[model samples]
Target: MRLTRVTTAELDRLEFHAVRSGEHAKVAAQLLELANQVDAGSEISRAELFVRAGEQWEFTQEYERACAAYQRAIDDGAATVVDARALRAGALLHLDEIGQAYAEFERLEADEPSSLQTYLHVAESLYAHDDLAGAERWATEGARLFLDQVGDPYVDDLLQELLRIRFRIRADLGLAEDALDRCTDTD
Candidate 1:
């Protein structure tokens, strides 16, 4: 498929279906070739293509390539800055770059303090790294933020997840008394 002759919309459709149908590697290669053919001034389009390439790489379990693609997206100022950063942090964590991942999450949190997604990602990352205290702190903060700012019913779902994570952290840390107190408070 010589995508050079195709319109941007066609390329998008092809790439989307290709990735969705589990032809990530093939789609990524096609995207790379198509990217080279696009004008240099198309930074936004290029960034989006790179992000899609990163997603393909991630789906195929290629963490390094995914991270590189996400970084390229970041450099190009892709529209999905939050998503790209989050995926990059996740890729870094998968690569065992714990410190770097933590830094990325922290930077994202600072940049988007009101974002529930950022809070959840930070808390989950901390939990994965066995930082129960940090996880609990972030989860609690997120729950409070959700309660104070978002009156949506969806906030309850998030609160439930946070509560579950907090309970797990408390149990893992041997804080049975605290856990019992939490249960009582909930009741």
Candidate 2:
């Protein structure tokens, strides 16, 4: 297989399908080989491959390995990429590095204040860290942002899912009124 011409986006899609088909180990090795094929100074490729490897390790429950891959991505200038920070933040969260994850998300939020996934992640992480108020605020922000910006009817299903989770989390935190209002609005 001529892997040299493969793009990072292609590798990412391949990795996803590989995981879905339970070829995690195969995907991991392929990602590592991809990393090796890139020159050390090829920061963009390095970051992307490392993130792929990290996600594979995460799926395999190799948290430490995942963390290392994410670290390599960072070391390879992931900070310069479009969604690198989000990927890094998600990796940190998966590794249970809550504080670091929070910092990364906060930084991303500051820069891209209306990103739905970022807000969703921040809310979920905050809820995990037992910050109900913070979680509620983030979830609310995420839901509103999604409604305002994401207009594809194809995304309606996901939006409904987000609404469900938001209400459930809010209700869990005793924000029943707010949850009810949001639910009605979504309907």
Candidate 3:
């Protein structure tokens, strides 16, 4: 394995090709191997390499590996600290590490999420775990807090995710849809 760091853009391009070829699992494994050799530094390239590897591992349904990659990213103190921790929690959930995952989630919630991404991930994980109530709580609150950021496309997209998860959770709980539910889709 090469010790020199690779650019995140290059990693993304590899992911693009891997996905396009329907061979992302193979590429994800390879990226993770590279990530293993990278320094746990906050430098842009190093940090992104770890996070990107985690994301690809997630795509491949390798939750244990994904958790490791995300943890590495977090240890590196990557700029997107919350995002990395949130992902690690989700990966832990997928690994059936319920107590650990919930502990992380509670910590994240107590700290208060500044980004809708955290809410979306936590909510989606809860929803997947059949915790509709928990999912609804996080998703609805996240959507409510970020509702005013419509003009900012990135926040809008994340807000939509939170809204979508909340909508699904509510639907699963047999709850009535409200005006806010309409935001899940234009129609």
Q: How close is each model in CA RMSD to the real structure?
A: 5.9, 4.7, 3.0
Best by TM-score: 3
**Per-residue lDDT for 64-103 in model 3, tens only?**
8889888887787656634777888889988899999888
Model 2: how far residue 96 lies from native, Å: 4.6
- Model 1: CA > 4 A from native: 1-21, 26-53, 78-83, 176-187
Q: By the TM-score metric, which is better: model 1 or model 2?
A: 2
Cα-based lDDT at residue 66, candidate 2: 72
Clash pairs detected, candidate 3:
none
Each model's lDDT: 0.70, 0.66, 0.78
* Winner of 1 and 2 under lDDT: 1
Better of 1 and 3 by TM-score: 3
Q: How does model 2 score by TM-score?
A: 0.66
Give the per-residue lDDT of model 2 (tens digit) for 101-147. 77876776787654455566566656766767777777777677677
lDDT-sorted candidate list, best first:
3, 1, 2
